[model samples]
Target: MERALKRYWPIFILPTLLAFLIGFIVPFVQGLYLSFCQFTTVNNAKWVGLSNYIKVFKDTTFTDAMKFTIAFTVVSVILINVLGFAIALALTRKLAGTNIFRTVFFMPNLIGGIVLGYIWQILINCVLSIVGEPLLALNTQAGYWGMIILTCWQQIGYMMIIYIAGLQNIPDDLIEAAQIDGASSWTTLWRIKLPMVMPSITICMFLSLTNGFKLFDQNLALTAGEPYHSTEMLAYNIYNTFYARAGAQWKGIGQAKAVIFCIIVVAISMIQLKATRSKEVQQ
Candidate 1:
């Protein structure tokens, strides 16, 4: 069986490899090249060297977007993980209708991002109208908090499912032993459950971090970076730079921003994984 599997490995892998190269690798390499050149299209690219990178740094809007995105990611990551884990702990207990509750909580995540954004926009606007702020786009703070709330609502359920799985995988004897040893519920959670769930934490954190960074559709539909682009995120900023601006130079600058964005996300994700994985206990 092993020999037969080995013989057919290339046959199984070749199509996926070819698809990946064609869909991702080739375009990525081309994008990197285009970042160094000014062009409206691939055929007419003119080499412009480091000027695009320089322009990216000099753009105040891009810097603002970076700051906004980082702030949002940090807040959203904390809220989603903590709330999700707490909900997971609750649901894993011998609660009534646990499956129904899980299904309802997770339903928000299944909704499209654009649809969620519009739904929240109208809901928030209505609430704010009672206090005289009729539109979310007009208030920068409202837009910021609205995005955070919307993200947390959508993501917590998914993270909760991961945490629930982790909790279930933990040996029942360990928890029972802790209780027999006179450990309080808090002590058992902190010293037993949380440590055992570090692997789930790592996975949930990585997903939340990346999703927060890459948020675009919600940002577009919710506030559209209104009130002078105060709520613009890095992804939306790059999109606007590429499509909203006229002239070919903006495309090169946009590509450079994208490359920088990719590097930042990759570096942060690697660091987060290393940090979290170190604390994970082997089952």
Candidate 2:
């Protein structure tokens, strides 16, 4: 098998390489090019250089979206990772019906973003109706909190499974050694368990961070950045720039925004990966 893989590596790689060129690399290069040009179609792109980028910064709505997105991401990442790790700790205990609880928790993650959005919207509205106002009308604070709750609820379960796997992989010998040293539970968790699970922590953090930054479907279906567009995030802002308004100018600007977003997300993920990878302990 090893000899076959080595001898026929090109054959195995070629199909996927071609598919990547077609599906990703080609479009990625084109999209970056489109960011600097103004056109209704790719073929007709007329180079406008930095004008779109300038417009992106000039738009206060885009700025607001950036702020909202960052705040949402911070809140969501904390809640998702902390709650997930806690649940993982709970489930890792040899408890009855643990499997059933895990299944119930993770089931929310499998639901479509749009469906979850509507469900949450209905639930929030039901509560808000008692006070005689809609969810969006309640203000930016409500929208912000709502989105955070929605994100955390959906993401925690998935993250929990990752943490659970990480916890289980910590060798029993290490725990016994720590116990022999007269370490308390908190001490062991902070010094031993956490260090051992750094890989899992990195994965969970990256997943939560990236997902928070790139979130769109739920943002769209839940708030749609409504009530004077107070809740607009980066993705929805880009969408509105391209399609909601009249003119090709915003389309080019949207492309520029998207390219910027891509750079931001990629750069952050890389930095986080590097930072966490350094701390990961060997088994």
The candidate scoring highest on lDDT is: 1
For model 2, the run of ten residues with the poorest summed lDDT: 133-142
Which candidate tops TM-score? 1
**lDDT, candidate 2, 106-212, per-residue tens:** 99999999999889988877777788766665467777788898998899999999999999999999999999999999999999989999999999999999999
Superposed model 1: Cα runs more than 4 Å off: none
Write one digit per residue (lDDT tens) for candidate 1, span 97-169. 9999999889999999999999999999999998888478789999999999999999999999999999999
Name the lDDT of candidate 1.
0.96
Quantify all predictions' global Cα lDDT against the true fold.
0.96, 0.91
